[model samples]
Target: MLELNDISYMAGNRTILQGISFNVRKGELLMVSGPSGSGKSTLLRIIGDQLSPASGSIRLNGRSILEYRPEEYRQKVSYVFQTPTLFMDTVIEDLEFPYRIRSAAPDMERIRELLPEVGLTEEILQKESRVISGGEKQRVALLRSLLIAPDILLLDEVTASLDRENARMIENTVKCLSARGMTIIWVTHDPDQLELSDRVLRIRDGKVVESIA
Candidate 1:
């Protein structure tokens, strides 16, 4: 379980999160929802350790997150932002990055199998990253983020721009991952997406207003 104790954050003297606390159980799919600027994204960023909260503590299975080294923590916590960036030239180059970081050979069979699941085909791997459509780029980015199957996957509005078909592909893929024991904390405003969650946490003005379990 991940335990958050009285979390708070500040941005240029403005409060982004205030005295927030929550717990995420193992393999649970927790959906976070709120209006714009309510600090939903910031909360996920804090949990991902992409940003440090001004106060409070975050623990993963009884251990403080701070105890883990930066590189080691990142491998266990994956964060997928709303706007994806493909840093490499070809789709395959970007997809192969995780393997490179781990000093392992590219898992071609696994990559090939996952491509179709995200509404892409084998040929997309050869396509130039800069030329793909927005939906396609998001698909490839999402696929790459999941390649290693981190312990906790933080998704922030990943499918908000996708068409129904593509969005369902991502939704189903994460649902499958969650069932297989990869804990997912998904941030979405879509009602359909909310229905897919194991719990819903709603916040406003930097504070949690409601939580449905």
Candidate 2:
């Protein structure tokens, strides 16, 4: 569903990604594993169009990503950062914001259902977002992203900081999404996460190597 051809990026004189290329099939769960500063996140940012590649191109559905409007592209390809940002006063407000932007009413029932799936409760949604723990905040951010039902989900170490239980919750939730045909590109260092992937690519020094399926 998505293809990256000879992708490269640079930060001033430093290279971030060099000659990176990969294809993520529809409904496939692809795991990107590498040490810090290996360009996994950069690869994701490029795919999400947050960073322009210095060379090469990204295609979604056989069309260049540049062909789609920025807002429209982002809606279809969602990126969840490792450290989730919640600027809203309450969790519910954060969750409702996406629907509000589309000028549609919030789906309360779906929100309620999703909350527990991510190890959160309905009551927590009423609490102040700033007061929540990091894990809770991450879960809320994840739920907010899923509320939009993006076609491709780019997860950047989303469960890196969560406890085992919470991480499992997220893994299972993502597996369910994959089962439903959502393309997932997950960046994680955890070996368990690697074990669950349909394909794994190891990146180092901005290069892709040691791919397994």
Candidate 3:
């Protein structure tokens, strides 16, 4: 469903990625694990269109990624950063953003169901973003985007902050969503996280080294 061909990127004088190519089918969970500075997250950033590649072609559903409107493309393919970003005063405001942008009413019942899946309760929504613990903040940030349910999710070390139990809970939750047809590209350094992947791709020095199915 998504394709990348000979993707290459350079940061000033240094090469961040070189000749990377891979394709992920619909509803696939692709686990990326690699050493620091090996460009795992950089690959996701480029795929998410947050960074322009020096040379490459990316296609989604047989159309060039560049052909789609930026907002529209991002809506279908969302990227969650390693660090959470919640600028709003309350968590509810942040969760309401997807509905606000689409001019659609939110399914609060659906949202409330998702809360406990990520180890959060509905009452936490009224709390200030400043008062939440770091893990709570991250979960809320991740949950905010899940309210809209992007077709493809790009997660960058997303569950790393949580303890193993919570991390596994989050992994299982996302895996369940993936089984229901959401494609996921996850970058994680933790070996235990690889358990849920449909396929695992290991990269070193900006190139694929090991691939397991």
Candidate 4:
């Protein structure tokens, strides 16, 4: 399980997160909901190790997240942003990113299997990322994040910008991944998406006020 204990993050005089705590069990889908500036995304960033908390600690299993190697820690827990950022020009380029980052060879067969799962055809591999719809790009980003077999996924409003069909596609993908034992921590304001969660946490002023299971 991924555990957060009394986690507090401060920016100069302002405290962004205060005594924030939770546990994300293996294969569980945890949805964090809040209004803007409630620090949902910031919490995700802390889990992803993008930001450091002023106090407290985060542990995956029994180990401290801060003790792991930077690259290896990132490989173990992947973060997917709300906005898609494609590195290479083509769809294949985006798909091949994680492998490049880890200096691993691209798995063509795995990539082929993932395309249809994300509602993309094999032909999409050849298309330029710049030409694809925003929804398609979001799926591409998701598949890319999973390429490295991350044990945990941190998503920040990942489906917020997609249409109904695309949003459903992404939600289904997340469900499948969690079913297969990938821990998920997602931040969103949509109640519909929260319906898919195993647990729901309501955040206010950077603190968890309610936890519904």
Candidate 5:
């Protein structure tokens, strides 16, 4: 479980999040829904430990995330952005990048199986990541993030750039993962995403106004 207590953030003179508090249960899909600039992305970043809250405590699994080693904590909690960012040239390289970073053995067979599950064919594995469509890249990014089997997944408008077909493909994979008990926290303005969530949090000016669970 992840818990945020009286979390607040400030940038220069402006306050972004004010006493934000929430608890995300294990295996629950928590959807943060609100207009742009409502601090959804910031909240995710805070939870992911990319950004620190000015005042508050963020606890993961009954302990503060700050107490864990950075790499170990990151492996347990993965964050995916709106756009697919790849470091390597090819699709396969990008998928295998995480394990490489951690010096872990590459599970080739598992990766190959995941590729098809994410709607990518074997032929495209050798191709440059830049050549793939935005949707394919996003799927690849997601696979890369899941290489270490993160306990918590934080996604920011993951399907915002994909077409309906591609979006659904990603959605299906996400739903399948959620069904298998992954902790998914996503930020979106899409009603469909809200409808699919186990819990919905509505934000206004960085404060949670209502929770539809």
Candidate 6:
């Protein structure tokens, strides 16, 4: 469903990514692992179109990503950062923001069903977003992303800040999504996360060194 061909990126004299190439098939969970400064997140940003590759190209469904409208492309391929950002005062308002932007009604029932999967209750939605724990906030951010129904999810260390239990909940939720056929490209340092991946790619100094399937 997604392809990266000879992708490379640089920052001044430093190289961040070099000739990185990989393909993520539909419904596959691909885990990207590397040491700090190895450019895993940069790779994801390129795929999400938040950053353009210095050389090479990214394609989705056989079409160049540059060919799609920015907003339309992002709706089909969403990116969730390591830290959750909720600008709204209330959880419901935050959850409803996406729908509000699209001029569509919020799907309260679906939202309610999604809460428990991430270890949250519907009552929490009525509370202030600022009062929620980091884990809860991350879950909320995740749910908000999923609500948009993106075909591919680009996750950048999303569970890095959460406690073990909360991380497990997020992991389970991601696995469930993959089972339901959502293509996932997850960047994680946790070894436990590797167990859930359909394939694992390791990078060193901006180049793919090993790929385990």
Q: Write the per-residue lDDT of candidate 3 for residues 53-152, one digit (tens) a residue.
A: 9998999999999999998899889888878888788888788778878898877887898898777998998998888877787778778877777889
Off by over 4 Å in 6: none
**Candidate no. 6 TM-score:** 0.97
lDDT of 1 by residue, 139-206 (tens): 88878877886788899999888788878888887888888888999999898789888999998999
Q: How accurate is candidate 4 locally (lDDT)?
A: 0.90
lDDT of 3: 0.87
Lowest summed lDDT window (length 10), candidate 1: 141-150
Which candidate, 1 or 3, has the higher TM-score? 1
All candidates' TM-scores? Answer: 0.94, 0.95, 0.94, 0.97, 0.97, 0.97
Top model by lDDT, which number?
A: 6
lDDT of 6 by residue, 95-148 (tens): 999899889999998898888877788889889999999989999999999888
Which is the winner by lDDT between candidate 2 and candidate 5? 2
- lDDT agreement with native, every candidate: 0.90, 0.90, 0.87, 0.90, 0.90, 0.92
Distance from true location, Cα of 179 in model 1, Å: 2.5
Greater TM-score among 3 and 4 belongs to: 4
- The sequence of per-residue lDDT tens digits that candidate 2 reaches over residues 171-206 is 888888888888999999898898778999999999
Give the Å shift of residue 77 in candidate 5.
0.4
After superposition, the stretches of candidate 5 with alpha carbons farther than 4 Å from their true spots are none
Candidate 2's TM-score reads 0.95
State the local distance difference test value for candidate 1: 0.90
